[model samples]
Target: MYSIFGVAWFSDPRKLFALVRQRLNLGGVFVFSQPPGSLGAYGLQGMYKGGFAGPAMYTYRFSYTHAMWRSLLLSAGLRRSRDLLHEAPKPDHIGTSDCPSRVPE
Candidate 1:
C-alpha cells in the first residue's frame, strides 16, 4: 500500500492503519509520504473550511514528529523498515516511512 499526501487527511489513523494491517500480505510493505512535523501546520487549526486558492472546500491535514510516527506504526502492528528522511533532497521535503507487515508480540 502506498499513500502520497493522503495519510494526513485521515480523520482516524488507527482505523486506517488497522485496515492497512488487515489487507497487507505477508512480506508486503506500506509506504507513505507526508510532511514532517518540523515543517509546522498546514491547514488552519489543523483543518480548513473555505476557499483555498480555488473553490470552497474543507481540508484536513495532520503533522507528526518522527518519534510519533514510530509509535503510531508500532501500535498498528507495523514495523518500520526504514525512515527515508535522510535520503530526501530538501530539508523541508516530504518524510517517507517504509513499513513491513511483521508485528512483534
Candidate 2:
C-alpha cells in the first residue's frame, strides 16, 4: 500500500517500475500520478522552439506521446494494468518557473 501524489515533475515509469518490482510486498499496489507531459520536457521543447539552445543539464527527458512512455515501462518489465489519459486544460503555474536554468539548488 503506497500513495504518491503531485510529484514535482514527470516520473520515469521505468524507474518507478523498477522500484515497484524490487520493493513492493506481495499483493501490494503502487498508486502514482503524473501530469500529461513532463514539465522539464515541455520547457526544453519550448526553449528550442523559441530558438534557445538546449543545455546538457535538462533534468526531465521524455517523448511527447503516450506510446513512447508505455514502451519505456514495458521495456522495464511493467505491465500496464490500467491507465487514464486526458487532454485537459493547463492550470495556472506557480512557484519557480525557471525550470531549465541549470542552477544547482
Model 1, span 23-74: residue lDDT tens? 8876678777765554564322345565467765766565666776667777
Cα-based RMSD of candidate 1? 4.0
Clashing pairs in 2: none
lDDT of 2 at 105: 15
TM-score of each: 0.68, 0.43
Tell me the deviation in Å of residue 77 in model 2: 2.4
Local distance difference test values of all predictions, in order: 0.63, 0.41
| True lDDT of residue 92, candidate 1 | 48
**CA lDDT for candidate 2:** 0.41
The residue-by-residue lDDT of candidate 2 on 1-102, one tens digit each, is 333332323455556556655665543454444445554453223212323457534344333345554554456444545555433455664212111111
RMSD of each: 4.0, 11.3
RMSD in Å for model 2 = 11.3
Model 2, C-alpha of 44: deviation from truth (Å): 8.2
Where in model 2 is the C-alpha error above 4 Å?
1-12, 38-64, 86-105
State the lDDT at 61 in candidate 1: 63
CA lDDT, candidate 1, residue 101: 35
